[model samples]
Target: MEYCSLIQLKTTMMNNFLTLFIAAFVFISCAKEKDPIIGNPGLAAQGEWSIPLNRILDGGPGKDGIPALDEPIFVSPQEATYLDDDELVIGHSSAQESKAYSHLVMNWHEIANDWFGQEPVAVIYCPLTGTATGWHRKLNNQVTTFGVSGLLYNANVIPYDRNTDSNWSQLTLECVNGELIGTRPEMVNLLETSWSTWKTFFPDTEVLSTETGFDRSYGVYPYGSYRTSEGLIFQVKDSDDRLHPKERVHSIISGDYVKAYRFSNFPETAAGIILDNVEGQNVVVIGSQTQNFIVSFFEKQINDEVLTFSLPSDDLYTNGNFTSSVILTDQFGNNWNAFGYAVTGPNEGDQLTPTMGIMGYWFPWTSFYTTVDIYGEQ
Candidate 1:
């Protein structure tokens, strides 16, 4: 029965490879919106692009001719009467027309550098964990910050721009006034761990830790895609050591629907497969029809690591159909197994409808275990 599925899967795979590629091309080029600001052309949506905080502080001389520097200014409660409640304001910069997030901006020092570009990224900052930052779409190479689930606990700063709100809307620090507030030191430390791994993405940028008792740090650089090109930036950080293991794990393409589990059965340490902790891992997913799927992994290093699997073309196909049952195992014998199929051309009665399958899972971890399952058939 497994061999039969392999035969049918192969037949379907070879016949459909060309059709699959052409269909994927048409769908990606013509179907999606591609930009988030098209429908809602607001300030933050239009004027504000995402950026790292370090770049905002020392991102070279802005149009206003001010060198980016870490200048945390304090204001007396008396000198300026509190007009807006539940908000902290940083001194206004005379250079740009708008004021950036002060508490959020002053929150951290710099991100750690590891792989060239493999950090978890997001656009919001969490005041509790102090790990919210964004890079401009134009400048970020369509990349993003990671480790947001851990940082969401302390999200207090809300950025509003003309696109989303009034252009001059006061940037405010709003929180549930009486809720439990965590320490800045711990949050700063977490931010350092997150960003330190991502410093490779920004070659020119330098990570600087806090001099004061606060755990805040800054990335110093002059020419970032954010400062001159867009306007502002927020630094992204690294993941926690516990949730993210020192070793990286990945999946196989035909291994789709095949879930990975840790052999250790450690409380929160289950991943696809474990490799050498000292060396990183490299894993790729290849589909029956080329270009039908993509494989990527996060929370693990994707450096020059060895992969020990191969898909034998002949073993996967029979009678114009390719069918196979593949099993992947950890060194300890725990395994994730699944079935796959392929074809050389469309079957006589099979309709050539293109399937748009965006295959990726979001595991929102917050010092806890969470899973985001995607249900689809295409």
Candidate 2:
């Protein structure tokens, strides 16, 4: 290399320094763009965070990375052969229609934006937490869609609404962060049971089809062994050992009170019915071991008559179909189905108001409601 004058050398050194500085600046900018935290600025600013923001890990998928089903397709139950007989499903019904969303499909996409009758709804399922529930998607009569926020609270999914960008805790059933903090979405009753049981209940129901616009192996479980494993993937601050951490339970929340009933607590052979006082409200829980189904409804009084229920005996007339009907007899010998509808008896055509409840794993229920009361306990 030729030697240069002092002034010329100084100028050359300055140029090299500027080049290095520009390269460093570009490198830092690109690095931040790749950061999950920096990529989600709206989520970063979410207020009233229940857990430490740093604890919310990138669940391998970014926001909307696991796409939500917006315009879901459906087919008759006969066409849903991909689902195993014992595989779980979320079932919902309105006055006009009944639908089933198989766990096989929900295992990949946790949220499905659909409608029940004329009312918009979001069917949400968290495989990690073993929770499946439905929420009214309309806020102040305006429709909103939800997506996976790539965040977890107590190992449960946190869904964010596309309209307000508000992050909601699936277990808590309320907006925990962003613009709609503390807002609770109206809940619709959803039944979680085996595919076989659901089909038995609603043979003519429509099933969510795998034609979800996204390319995902709907037959394969995305979380792998996590579903069967007892250990949690993320940290949860609270727990209760009354039931197995992964044991499934049917939970009901009313006002500030919550209660959970495990499958083990139900009678093994026949149908069992229990009336419990929850938050001063009389709630009736009905379970069928043979059917593998449990549901709760508020005790209703018609014409100042309080209805108490019991499992219908074998002799009761069940529309000539005892195997398929979940018949319950009141003190007056009126027959009712699991849905609290008086099908045949003196009270025929009457309806028992259904209470909004959920079926989920024990750990997540306890993690969200630490003080939840367990049925049959003091």
- Using lDDT as the measure, the top candidate is 2
Say which candidate scores most in TM-score: 2
lDDT of 1 by residue, 300-363 (tens): 1113433233333444433322232222222222222121111222221111111111121111
Q: Which stretches of candidate 2 lie over 4 Å from their true place?
A: 1-44, 47-55, 313-322, 332-334, 344-349
Q: Please give the distance, in angstroms, between residue 292's alpha carbon in candidate 2 and its true position after superposition.
A: 1.5
Q: Candidate 1 — which residues are off by over 4 angstroms?
A: 1-124, 137-156, 162-205, 208-378
Q: For model 2, how does the per-residue alpha-carbon lDDT over 279-376 read when each residue is reduced to its tens digit? A: 88889988765667778999888668898777777664343323444457888767876566777788787878877678888887655664688898
Mark the 10 consecutive residues where model 2 has the least summed lDDT.
34-43
Q: After superposition, how far is residue 337 of candidate 2 from its true place, in Å?
A: 3.1
